[model samples]
Target chain A: MAALSIKDLTAIAKKTKESMQISAQGPHTKITVHMGTCGIAAGAQKVMDSFKEVLEIVDKKDVILTYSGCAGLCSNEPMVTIERYGEKPIKYINITPKIAREIMKQHVQKGNPLKEYIIAKGYENIV
Target chain B: MGDSTMSKETKKKEKTQTIPDLNSVPFFGRQILIALRNRGRINPESIDEYIAHDGYQALAKGLTKLKPTDIVEQIKQSSLRGRGGGGFDTGRKWASAAKATGEPKYVICNADEGDPGAYMDRSIIEADPHSVIEGMALCGRAIGSTVGYVYIRAEYPLARKILGHALEQARAYGLLGENILDSDFSFDIFIKQGAGAFVCGESSALRASIEGNVGEPTPKYDHATEKGLWKKPTVLNNVESFANVPPIILKGAQWFSAMGTEHSKGTKVFSLVGKIVNTGLIEVLMGTTLRDIIFEIGGGIPDGKAFKAVQTGGPSGGCIPESLLDMSVDFEELSKAGSMMGSGGMIVMDEDTCMVNVAKYFIEFCNSESCGKCISCRDGSEAMLEILTRISEGKGKEEDITLLEELSNAIKEASLCGLGTSLPNPVLSTLRYFKEEYQEHIVHKRCPAGVCKALITFTVLEKNCTKCGVCFKNCPYEAITWKKKEIAVINQNQCKKCGICYEVCKFKAIERK
Candidate 1:
């Protein structure tokens, strides 16, 4: 290994960016569970567990699970953001474990995001 | 020169790339994540994820292109100050260390955040440890130091674990150790675990603790930049301050400077806790008002309780009343309002929170954390704590008010470090803003907020009670007795005054008199 040069670092950054773009295009779905203190207070942990259980049941291979801090509007906590590749992200608020499982079953498995629990649509660039 | 300018312009252009639907993002309207840019967006454990989000690119840029002096100049131009309570200029500290003659100069990131309700440092470290590491490396390069130390508190186990992993990852990828980015400069970092002393958050005290001495603050007659850590010139900046470096270097000073107030540049991350509805870490522009932070970002106080006051800084900080809610939260502005912005602990106290008790609680914290170095801090804190305790317990004499103030001022005038100096703030500020409450506590012998346990009595109201068995089951000492379809009665004798029945009462039946 030729002592990682600046050029190599830049190239790696470029590769990662390109991979990010590719992931954004298709073949993956990203789930962002807000785990800020407020979210946790509103039962985000159980919501996250629900997401994990539902996702496992659906068994989607290309799903990405990540946690985010508070989104400021903590009133609508236990917030989850679901982004399907090549589409705008949807944000669901005031989510329970049952709602999370419903979301996983209806949205992740069948390409349809639940509208009732959603506070906002096309919230992809929010963070 | 033209080609470099073109690249710089392009970098600037790229920096301005906006995240679409920022308005739609639930809380993005009020939040500006500069220091916390990669916080929730990236996987903190993966260096690749960090890099993808423009992480170590700044380090690479600083190393390959900019000289050490140039990086320092850029920091100076940006007007970036410390976020670890002092609000001192980051560039000046680094420049002095660089100017100081030493064989192996040192850079230290002070992550020993010990504010009672503050976890801003720990959160940043846990969420984005690589950013902190990158910031440290950039500081080392700027200050001509080849080694750095991250003195984080042992209480933050998760942050420590993540930071340790981040260091290992950086070393493995050659981002740390042996000529980073293949430049002439080779920088490495080590973690110095603090023994959970609040005083160790002080600069020289932290330096002393790292050197295996008792964690006590020393008088700073000489600047730490000129003499620190084994008598070597050292640059010490806080976790948040270091985390801000990579962004400042990646973007220009102008970008960082553009976000905050005229004097206080860049964003501040506050752990908005206490009686607020949304209690979490929030990063907002420096000039953002306390009203916005408390009401807007914090979702106001929970359960419709009226907002009484918001306490900024920490145990060493003052309580700003609702009257000063509109005041812009910055270093200078906070000081003008009788409080220094001590490490971004914004604790929102509601109407139920008694200011005297708040003052007493903080004084107790200060008394415990005092290094016992000075007579005023040691004895004065104990005395102040004693008076506050007496006043809170309804044993306050009319003269106790003036006595507390006198002792608080004495401690403030004669203290070795910031901890001791700021010890008087909570009491003084509460006295200034909420004097009526103190008068009530002292002259009237009443706790207006129902917070001082001794001053308030818990009673079960028959009119409102719906035969609720909740309080009966919830009371720790079985203080409440209830038959079905009958009002619950609280046994004054058995009541430990724990207020569990009052809290658990569903019907507004439990009254505090």
Candidate 2:
């Protein structure tokens, strides 16, 4: 392997950082799927696929789908958090693929989150 | 390490899905993630993902501007101590190795985390293996060493695989192999998988295992920094200690020193498990209060169970009662409170947990893990386990408590290695904190928490029974009998007295006598 110069290493690091910043600057809606062990065991995979299919069906351009680890609540598995640009992030627990479709259609599309499935709301104020 | 397959699925999910920016959440404020900064945020397999988070900037700075001794001096200023429970001064160890007159010095990152509940090291390796490698390479530069080894346990398959991949990436990118980053410093690292022996986590035993020996700790008359693997000077550091190095280098030593207490610098990661509402990996500053960790971070004990005690350190460490919950968690304070931080395993217990049984559990662990090289640790711990078992079985005499204390102190003093020297911690700590519980068992033959099977008798309270059948359905031994519209009965002949029915009883139908 060719030796990397100091300039080359610095440039690579700088490029990586710039790319990371680019992703953070958009006004996109972020949906975080909790994919911890409990989440996976409780059918989080199918839930994630449901989200992907829903977004594709709607042709949502600015929705940024993400994944997170366990929130330390194993009992409430398959949790999902949705953060819009200006609204408070809403956390929904014990979700299924059917519930994922409802979350996308009602919350993501029409801005009406189902209050019954919500574990936490107004998380923005805590931050 | 215990559940790497599960974590691997999490990692795989992380790779495909975009990660939420943690800066926007309140969750980041709860943790100080120096070692785990890029864990959930970045993809582990991608070196560029690590670099984007300001990783390896320290190695770049160290190689370009600083001399070998200058880096050592910076570490000394940081006052960073070893995180693998020893609490030795890290910079001093480096200085000793740097000063030692050896032709070829080696650096070893101790990833053999054998503590039962401790997975802090495993999490670091699995989540951010590059950080550990970068830290190792920087240490090699500082100590003027060219070769490094990460002695991880075979049980940590995910960590070993991830670390092996990271090393290959580093070599391909000219960060590990010859002429690293076009500098004069050339270092390479190898992964040595331990056969999952708890004793191999010790420094001498690890070195012996690496050298194809029986993995028994030799007398530590000579430090490994002077004479280690193959009789060469070696710098051995824990996984967390090495992971802390790059951050200290990139952000100045003063920045790293500013977070923790006076003696212990930087954040410490802990595997917080057992009876807590939030049982996960947590990283906090060195001097954070135990109350804050247990209440604020752990979200307190689950199901309204009152917190009884926390077993810190590991099998080698002791239990801290509820009275000392406000005690600051640092190397000195925890040791002063009769528990050394053994690789940061915090096992929380509730009021229902039996203190005597807890001591017995740790004694059994130590007895099984003790290498028979030392007769005192081997035979002495067996004797302690036997006595603890007898006490829990309602067969103990009043003299057994004093005998246990005496045997523990003797084993602690006479044993050679760390396993033997700290073998008495669990028994001694329980004796110091909850001696009354032991007395209750020996004198009254009563197990207060109803954990000891031989001491407790399970009886069904007909008045409290609503024919719910919860206990009958949940009992593993099939000891409970009930028909429709009838109170459940526990057959004395069939009952193993395992306490499953007691735990499962929702209406307080099962009573312990």
Candidate 3:
């Protein structure tokens, strides 16, 4: 691979951001699976695989999938949070592969939420 | 149709009532993520995801916009102190390394985190390895060094693998290695794994281990910044400290300094563990109170137990009692209260936990980990551990406490390294705070918390037994005998005083005598 110059860095950052963005502003649907050690111990990897399978079947191009670290509430592991464009993000706790499929079908494909598994709505005010 | 409409209406009501706002939860609300900014937002394996979140922007700015001296000046202005327990001024360390006469200076990231129940460094590296890399690169630019080394432990295989992958990605992107960002500056980082020795976390011992020598600390007659890593000027910072650098460079120094107390700047990540309900990694401002961290962020003690004390700074730190829960958790305040903030390991204890046993456990750890290079540390820790053991076993004399204090002072004064100096903090701080618990053990020959097996006996209270049979079923030994609809009887001869029945009893029927 070739070494990137200073100008190339800004260009790459801009190009990646633009391509990764689903809409002009941001992704229309974003899914963040908490895959920290705590979360993985509670079967987050299975949950992640389930999401991949569901996304493949549904074939939603506007949806962005990613994984991050612990969300602090370790007791509620294998947690997944979904954010729709211009809507409050909803966090679902103690998720399973079956639940992941249900969530992808019901919440992601349709606008209605699976209210029973939802832990919280909206992001924590982190300063 | 009428049934469907009714179900839909009920679902709407339940949704509104059950889904609470995230900010309303204290565990999530109390934390601020500056150093852990990319933790739950980006995939660590993907450098493109990191770049989308402004990962290498700080390095780009440092390389293009600022000079080496200017970078050091900005950090100095930020007032960022070392997060790796000493609380030394980071910029001053960098400045001295920049000015010190040497052929080739070096940058070292101390990731050999050995604190029990503390995984903040490991989590940071696993979640966001680029932050540490970028921070180290920034430090290299400031200190005029081309080579950097991340001294990690072999025990953390996952963290090491992730960091290794991140380094490869950064090198491919021209963020690391020669001529980074096509500039005149060139810097590369390598990882060196330790054998997971507790004393190897010390700077001198870590440097010595990197040099393929015995992992023992020498006296810091000269600072590592002056003579370190092959006896050349070197700048060493902890995993967390280096991770904070990129943010400080990107956002102005004023912005970083504005978040923390007057003396300590920026946020600190703590691994909250032991008896707490929410045991996980949390980051809060430097001046956050123990009450907020323990009760609010930690969700208080579990099992409906009364809070006894909280031990901060790992085994090397001191146990703080209930009275000082409101104390501000800054570096100065903790040391003032007889505890130092040693790498942010907060272990909460409940009423069931015995304070004397707590002291013994930490002293035992320190004693075993002693390098034995200094007689004061090796022998002093062994002596203190003996006294603590005696006290916990209900055979302590009245003068034992005073003797432990004297030994603590001697070790602090005569020890060659930090391991020996802070070894007695657990004993000294427990004595300072929970002296009455110690008095109860020595004077009455009783373990009030029922922890010391030799000092207490278990008996089932008939009124609260409820014929549960939980103790009888759970006992590893056939110590408790019970029948249907009858109170359980503990066979004193057979009982080993293991307290398994005491823990398993749901009705609190098992009493210690």
Every model's DockQ:
0.29, 0.21, 0.58
Reference A-B contact fraction recovered by candidate 3: 0.63
lDDT tens string, model 2, B1-513?
A: 758978876764453233333333323346777876765455566687787777778899999889999899999889999999989999999999999878689999999998878888877887678999999999999999999999999987767887898888888888888888778899999999999999999999999999999999998777778888788889999999998999888888999899889888888888888989777777888899999898887788999989999999998899999999999899999999999888999999998899999999988898999999889899999999899999998899999989999998899889989999998999999999999999999999999987888988999998999898988898888988988888899999999988888888888889998
- Which lDDT tens digits does candidate 1 get at residues B242-323? 9999989988898888878989998898988889876667788899999988888777888889999888899878999988
Those runs of model 3 whose alpha carbons end farther than 4 Å from true positions after fitting are A23-28, A60-62, A124-127, B1-18
Looking at candidate 3, what is the lDDT of residue A1?
75
How good is model 2 by TM-score?
0.88
Give candidate 1 regions above 4 Å deviation: A21-25, A33-60, A66-80, A91-100, A115-127, B1-26, B466-474, B481-488
Query: How many clashes show up per model?
Result: 0, 1, 0
In order, what lDDT does every prediction score?
0.83, 0.83, 0.88
Query: How far off is residue B97 in model 3, in Å?
Result: 0.2
User: Which residue runs of candidate 2 sit more than 4 Å off their true CA positions?
Assistant: A18-127, B1-28, B473-478
Task: State which candidate has the highest DockQ.
Answer: 3
lDDT of 3: 0.88
- Highest lDDT: give the candidate number: 3
Worst 10 residues of 2 chain B by lDDT: B16-25
Question: Which one is best on TM-score?
Answer: 3
